[model samples]
Target chain A: MKQSALLDHPFGARYAAALPAADAARQDARETLALEGLPGPKREEWRFTPLRGLAKIPFIPAASADDIDVCDLPADVPRFTDAHRIVLVNGVYRADLSDTASETGLTVTEAKTPDHGVDAPLAVLNAAYMSGGVTISVRGVVAKPVHLVSIGAAGAEPAAFHPRLAIAVAPAAKLTILETHHGLPGQPYFSNPVTTISVGTAGVLRRYVLVREDSEAFHLATTVADVAADAKFDAFHLGLGGALVRQEISVDFVGEGAAVRLNGAYALMGRAHHDFTTFMNHDMPNCTSSQVFKGVVDGESRGVYQGRVLVARHAQKTDGQQLHKALFLSRGPQIDCKPELEIYADDVKCAHGATTGELDPDHLFYLAARGIDPQAARLLLVQGFLADALENVDDAVVRDILSGEISGWLMRKASA
Target chain B: MALLEIKNLHVSVGGKKILNGISLALNAGEVHAIMGPNGTGKSTLSNVIAGRDGYDVTEGQVLLDGQDILAMEADERARAGVFLAFQYPVEIPGVTTSAFLKTAINAKRRAEGKPEIDAMEFLKLVKAKQKLLSMPDDMIKRALNVGFSGGEKKRAEVLQMTLLEPRVAILDETDSGLDIDALKIVSEGVNTLRGPDRTFLIITHYQRLLNYIVPDHVHVLVGGRVVASGGKELAEQLEAEGYARYLSAA
Candidate 1:
């Protein structure tokens, strides 16, 4: 049978016909069409993550606008009043639920086609039938941060949702954006999201993402950020709770004097799985970037971190450092980390390192010898290991919120 | 009654005897110094008393304050008020000294069914002890002994010892890397904690530390055994004459 016919069987024929025109990208997608169920052990990245439920769940596009209810923001959730807020419910942007205005130098529109070299099948699928996605642009410098909130609500039936967002920061402009993923109670769904961000010359942008999904939920997201000359981008990611999640971030430094700092922390327990994959490309000179990611895995959980820094020949003086470390709290738990640096320029300073091990026995002994219980000692050591990455977050309120969330998660895991 | 009593202790590491038939008794309000050469099993005796793992107590009974401590784990023994000032304190990165000390103190307190100490109370206690040890406030704020000078590390160990307030403290060559000033400061800290309820075992290679903290009893450890025991005068004799005679005899 032809590849298109296989994709047509589960997801309608029309969806399969909308595959990307890029032959190589489509071929790669087609070859994996037989993966009707979750990407299993056969897939390299999904080897540690369980996804059988995601593969077996029938694929259904988001329901009509009236079928989804948009509730008021929970009191516990922080709000940015001055900034424009765009809310997406179950992969569909709800205009009635959002407070965005096109006249405010920001526009929210549905993308007709995957524009600007987005040839991946997932991107094409998001483009072909995506319901609600906003195109946010700051014509000039904007004083306020733009908040984009995407939420996945559980429906009565097994469902899947794909949310797409395209962002463009104009020259010399600054933007701070916050994105959160929340699963409604009884909402068992699969969320596959793709966001593309472009920073113009001398622009600055800070993006904070918090992912707290239900344990039964499956989340797959990819973020592509491109930086122009003299631009700076900082991103902080916190993965607190997820059944199985893989977040991939790719940043391309296309112009000289551009800089980026990527920091993330993942605290997971139970049978949950969380993976973070980052790829940084330095194509211009005098560009700098650093990434510090730490994870704490307990119970039967698993964590994976794969980071790569690529420096081209012309990308000289590209100071890049990547460090990934993980602490395994239980013998049944495991963490796999791979940090790689491929440098082609002699003048560039690039280094990468990865370490995965259990908590230090000596530190534990030291704590215990001081009269602390074994459980509390483990918690303290885990917190110390994650402190460096947590301190990297510049916003105090956000940092406090993230820390509290992580502590709560850990406490619950310890009790459970 | 003695606060700590070791009877016929025989400890071996990796199938080699390090402490053979060693015995000692420590009474409250008393300091006993054990002076010996480098390979005289001074450290092994301290470690064995602290219940360090992998040290096979082939034949021995370690009693702390009338309780058999050899059967307890390291932490249990610590809670029972036995502390070992490590010769080389382990450096823990990313953990502040103050936070570590507070956690340790509270851990012990909590294990004893006591309420946790408040933040202000902890700060007050730390400040008072810092003044006693003449340690800078920054030393407590920095990562646990990370990037600290050798003398600073030794001072930090003394600081912990003062805060934990163990009933029987064993200083295992803590003066090895200290200068005269640091040695005096550390000894002063130990002296301040000295009381009728507390005892100490100072283990060192030279009698230099003995000058600062005079011991009531001095024992010459040779060939994994206490070859000679005498009053404080024994330390002076060993200091005037070196370990040359003892080394040759062993």
Candidate 2:
């Protein structure tokens, strides 16, 4: 409800001079950001979660922040020994710490600075301060997954950075992309990343993202995927930790018979807040899209899930379904779930559902009666509650690691 | 010494009296059957003994190994060697049956200061006991009782009983959903666990189960009170003659 200046974070001519993309068209992005500030409480999309905390912080551009040491990956990162990894720190590529040379069907290069083309408020901000990212092109079937690790660390002052990723999969190609976003402890760092993906006809793209930022960090990520005819885009988004984090995904069914499965799960505690907003545009006929998101909130935390599916009039036979369920660990936490379906096609089958409830006492009692104590019983149930969504991750190794991470979060909550 | 003793137990559910001044004692290794017509607090007594919630003991005490179990949580009582085979075994999805059984076994071990069961040994034991119950080899791989048939649910309950090896086991209408074949396999499973260190309280509405795992003593409860107490013969008598006489007598 507080009205503040749109340029509260201070991005002026001096700020643009320090950016990595010197040749990028900066005037349009700056003007766009100047026109549209951070989303406020009045906007329905930002109603439940307030960005007042972000507006209050004096976040300098990450390009201007001291060169954070990029010697090692975060200790919490799951080292997938089988996958080829690409490392980035403070939005800039870190070739010194990368293992991408052995990868096949992957060519990593610098991405063009993003354009502010009638995008959302956060996307505009990402454009205005875009720093550095890579473009990955895939052809044929990739034997190993391509892992993208983005690390953020602030020095001396609070900092913010926007990393842009562009991906293209050739026709009949198959690839898996694993992304992890982590930051060092201390400092309220802000990370905004925009990812654009294009899956050619009959191509297959499997994406798995694990976001674990600092307890005081802010992460606003937007991902746009364009699926061609008969292409399959399967993705799982896992939100583990952050002070203010929102992972928004938009899928455009650009070709007929395309299929998309977007599933995610979040486990949050303390004052941490997370939101998963998805928009699936069914522009072509006979396409299918499904979204399943589950979360657990504790310690006065807040969780949100907003899903919208739009089916055009000509997009007949569009099968779209979405469900969001949140489990509250304590009375102090809050959950806001909104599921919207706008279907213009009469032959489409679209269903959206949202459920927010505390742990089922019956389930808890059943576990307890089997000799598991209340705490462990609750933990087991929470794991089970999020299992269906976690099952979306097709890779066995990644699935196990994510499940382990969730268990660790639950243990921390128990001890806290 | 009695392994379990229910002394003048008066239980109420949701402020309504279900059990009125019930008294019973079972020494270790004894199998006692509590039977009656429907709505006679047969299941209520079993639930109260297992430390289930929603049932308030308005009076009296239920003790296990001389320790007052009514004051303990359901899980505490379970770790202290109390088991309840729910009439309707809950279908817990995502937590596999093997995982639940392992946790239960580990819980008992932890309470007794014993090392946790080795995973291989645990699997071998489950396989052997599951064979006794005629359960499928992959039954343990499925989520705990989820999507299982009526008979499979009852069999899974008996499987948990076989694994936990509690000191005092309460089978609350375990025969309710089972067919005659499942009943035989489940009863055979229970009969194998009969030993000097363990005891059983089988609560049922029918005496058909008593034919398989014969009880040492049978008590006929009516109107929340034990109206008749006899040996296994009482079960047969009750089966032959309906509880009409006892219902009116109470």
Candidate 3:
């Protein structure tokens, strides 16, 4: 591994020079990134989603771009009633636009450079150039949800930003967080976000993420969560817009009787590409994990879902289930699905299924016979297909918000 | 002129002839029952009239209110007042029954230059219609026909027919999966919708359904063409003797 790998890429010396003085952790991450560069097609995890197109772009540090400014929340951003607002522009927190009011049992502070031993390429990239983010801690039942909105903008030239977020729930505590990633349209910008979460024993955490970046922008996010005994972690990720986007989530069950429900849905059109990669590590006995992912692709777009569940030899009574279903609106779109289940325990129950199909003609004809036009019929069917995954989101408000985003995407595709 | 007319219609599936020059005409305020044995193109007639794909008209004219409707697409024909009560209605998951009903009603209304149905008004209308069919109030909140029983699916079809109020309504094998009670309930639903402006084309293999709805005319179809036509008594005669005579004649 030579330093030329990083030098040849956009995030070499120039990106490092613009960043703040680094600590030992950041320096170690930068040296690792310089050694490995970005994951390429040879890496099995990155095979489906190649970063060649992303690496070719000469992107400057988003912090160095002084022309970009976001003074207010975007008009299209849905206002979640009673939820605390947290706004981030170009990866940096905006105090003026955010709601800094503190609530009981909940704390929010500027995220520090913590040594999270994550070796993934993108996670390393996030650590190497991490600019701004927040750390939210829950000590007791937090009644109100926290809404974190990340906004990205590039002026004159392509800009890149990396944000780090950490969340910790104390024993027997509960919390819910919603993340919405959006950006302005101009020169293509790149957003790299890494989130680390920990749920204490007997605790509960519900995290919902929605990504609708500009069509010309690039977004790659990674989330790692650890669940303790008798804890529950429910999460849903939705991807609707972006030229290229990938959401990777990894969950590690560290105690018995823990439960995790990870579900996601994506709707893509044009040349947009979206990918979801998940890893479930069942290291403790009596832990259960389930993943239901569904997506709809149109135009020349591409959708990918790669999920791996590993059960340790001692982790008996592990229950893991994963299913991926994709619908293609036309002949041009492509779907790649890979589901891997490794059960070293003899008493584990693990099942995985993947399916790709077009809209059922009978369904279309049924709607058509009822006077619904072909376009509207298609839209209804697509929404119905993705609704299976959306139903997994237990929170009604969050479900409706994601549904609205998917509906918006469908309407845009219908007109296009 | 007849409210719905089928004149010298010929249809084929996979280049194989199914309906061989079959024709029928239903005047305003009339229920015409087409009784035939299996493989006699009974379903084909209903599908062709409702504009289903994979069927080659080859040669035919299906007219609604004196206009040839074979040129219109399925949805266009539906908006132009054509409805088909499918024997096996498709099960569409995740599409709530209420949402589907509203979309259909709105489509018809939009085509007629009327405003869309408001949420409250739509719910009220569906509730009223559901009561007429003895449907549970929460049925509309479930996915469209996804988990419905056979009887419930048939009743839902009648509910749609009642809502859309099409000029020409075709019921294909609507009695196949219904029990006696469901049949009576479904027939009553059809009876309530029969009026001077509407005509019904009931396509069934058995004459049991006619006992409730009481068609004005009954035609015996065999081997893709009508072998005989007569008054309502024709249905009773077939019910007693079966379609052995018609099959031999064809």
For residues B1-250, write the lDDT of model 2, one tens digit per residue.
6999999999999899999999999999899999999999998998788777789899999888887889999999888888988888778767878878888888888988999999999999999988888988899988888899999998988888888888899998999878889899999999999999999999999999999999999999999999999999999988999899998788
Clashing pairs in 1: A37-A55, A38-A55, A93-A132, A154-A187
User: Please, what are the lDDT tens digits per residue for candidate 3 over residues A1-416?
Assistant: 33433324688888788767789888988888878889877678888898889988999989988898788899988778789888989888888989857889999888767457676789999898888888889999999999999998999999998888889999999998999999998999999989999999999999999999999999999889999999999999999889999999999998999999999999999999999999999999999999999989889999999999999999999999999999988999999999999889999899999988999999999999999999889888998997767878888898888888888887788778
Interface RMSD of each: 1.6, 1.2, 0.6
Write model 2 residue lDDT over A201-307, tens digit each, in one string: 99999999999888899999989899999999999999998899999999999999999999999999999999999999999999999999999888889999999
Please report the candidate that would top lDDT against the real structure: 3
Clashes of 2: 0
Tell the DockQ for candidate 1: 0.44
Report DockQ per prediction, comma-separated.
Answer: 0.44, 0.69, 0.83
Give the higher-lDDT candidate: 2 or 3: 3
Tell me the spans in candidate 3 whose CA falls farther than 4 Å from its real position.
A1-7
Model 2 steric clash pairs: none
Question: Is model 1 an incorrect, acceptable, medium or high docking prediction?
Answer: acceptable
Residue B237, candidate 1: C-alpha displacement in angstroms: 2.8
Sorted by TM-score (best first), the order is: 3, 2, 1
Error of 3 at A114 (Å): 3.6
Indicate which candidate wins on DockQ: 3
Ranking by DockQ: 3, 2, 1
Tens-place lDDT per residue, model 1, A198-234, is: 9999998888888887777777887899999999899
Model 1 earns a TM-score of: 0.87
